[model samples]
Target: SSLGHHDIIEYLLNHDADPTITSIKNLTPYDLAKDKETRNVFRRYMAEHMDKWNWSNAHVPIEKSESTSSASKKNGSSISGKSLDSSSSLIGLPAEMRTRIERERRARAAEVRLNAMQNRGTPKPLTLPSIGNVICNVCEKSLVGLVPFEICELKFCSTVCVKNYRDREST
Candidate 1:
């Protein structure tokens, strides 16, 4: 959801909405909200009906760097106040856990660097095959080095034409 419906959220809270519900990403309503505006709105509604919440509900403690601005401060309670970079307690964490996370991060960085290096290499020039005539499925134009689309052995002249063809099929 885009999180745009303020009135509906207010009504839902009034009728007993659970702010602690964990999303697919394991984020609470307080975590998923992108900005201070939505956080404040949720906080205000929650304050108005604090009795409905089960304060004892266990929520996964998110890392401080992942905390949103408003939810990480104000309202007398902050989920995560400090940046994860400043968290020295990671040194005390079990070696396997720290090593695993560090390894994964390093691997991802290595992959990204590899991809960057590959992209930096010269791009091979697209060549027209000598065998057959390649024609655009949408505009029926002759295809050169690149065709906009390649559906099922079919080619399109441009991105616009490919989208138009898809829309035509859907409608």
Candidate 2:
């Protein structure tokens, strides 16, 4: 007789019905699943039989897999009108604040690029009346073009001068 239902197929398989048992036409039940739906139904029946056979075994406890829990965690409990993850888990922002932050970041980047361009190459040494040679404020030595410094209303010849001048100004 042709297997018409999943329960019968599962029951027969569980009782050790030979999977190799072929019909007179030389086809097994697995071979008769010619379409996707029929194949899926047959697959489910096979799974049920496996489950029953596993249950009959003495050793295995058969713990449920965490796949269901993980799925529920991702989907959240919104469907059940309960809290899922906290609202703090989501990205929080008003449109204006987001736009302003982006704008400020762009402005800072542009300023950095401008400063880099201005600072490129060797800096020119500053000349002064007291020292015909450009002088360093900290060491009081002749400053070279290698280091540049700016003070209030005066340009200095070395980084030492710039730092010392600023330190003096702060006090």
Candidate 3:
């Protein structure tokens, strides 16, 4: 949602958010890219992780090159003038304007990161944890599936974690 913000876009992509998803207007993430660099971030990601996703569905341009920055500046867009004004022209703006844009980018990135973290909510058991292999909601330890142990829909790796969860809730 943080359009024009490369870091935020990268973060969302890294977290497995679908990039090819379209808005009501049928605009894709590539369609919403605010600058050549931002578009390149998507391209680079697709290049780095080839088998991870169907990049054709990503809708980003396939022009993979280091000279894309200069090319976009010269041509205004990779889509052969189909796209409108991009932030690539921002290079000609005054220093203060560039600084303001930078501030806005950072603010937007922070807002996106916060939203992403908040949306994750509680850990879903069996779904990979953020760090190590954790399937337990309490201790966050990887559970042995030989036996099922659950309380109120929460899974635990051990009885100790269950006890700890109950003890904390009672306090």
Candidate 4:
């Protein structure tokens, strides 16, 4: 019997509260479950402790089964074939989840490879083409017009190239 305080209901159950005890509404705590989540919680708790409640068809813990032992033996043999140290990182995740993650990783790697291959051997437009043969001093490439510095009469293709050359010389 509760006013929907699920935590209090759980605490009462943990402390040996009688499940059959009814409230003024003539409803036991299990009967008073107002929502699906609460009902599911109650069902799972009852399933886990069915033996303690003297219930018929009690579920045995899965870890104590013979199938688990055989499955573990198979897993151990399979694990031995791989690098044990590398497998430790993903030990907690399920096989399907890990496979999905690996697939995504491979997809990203392939995308990057494709982008690199597409860009390979393609000439990048670093600067606009020059109209005359006035060459830049820094890159030795023809500039639209010589950008002359009075100090050394140095010419550059662009302002960006001239600034980079000046920065390097200053350092």
Q: After superposition, how far is residue 136 of candidate 1 from its true place, in Å?
A: 47
Q: What is the TM-score of each predicted model, taking all chains together?
A: 0.31, 0.23, 0.37, 0.29
User: What residue pairs are clashing in model 3?
Assistant: none
Candidate 2 accuracy as lDDT: 0.47
lDDT tens digits by residue: candidate 3, 1-171: 436889998898899988878764345787678887888788888878767876555555333345645766576575663334445545566987666655655555654664465358653454443544436666444565535478877787768777877886687
**lDDT winner among the candidates?**
3
lDDT of 3: 0.64
Q: Rank the candidates by lDDT, best first.
A: 3, 1, 4, 2
> How well does candidate 1 score on lDDT at residue 42?
72
39 Cα displacement, candidate 4 (Å):
1.7
- Backbone clash pairs for candidate 1 read none
Clashing pairs in 2: none
Better of 2 and 3 by TM-score: 3
Q: What is the C-alpha RMSD of each candidate to the true structure, in Å?
A: 14.0, 30.7, 16.6, 25.3
Model 4 accuracy (lDDT, Cα): 0.51
Q: Write the per-residue lDDT of candidate 4 for residues 8-112, one digit (tens) a residue.
A: 767777887766565542345665677645554555567666645622111111111345445556667435333234344345669975665456445546545
Candidate 1 lDDT by residue in tens digits, 110-139: 545644643574322222356566655444
- Candidate 2 segments whose C-alpha is farther than 4 A from its true place: 1-3, 33-38, 45-171
Q: State, as a TM-score between 0 and 1, how close model 1 is to the true structure.
A: 0.31
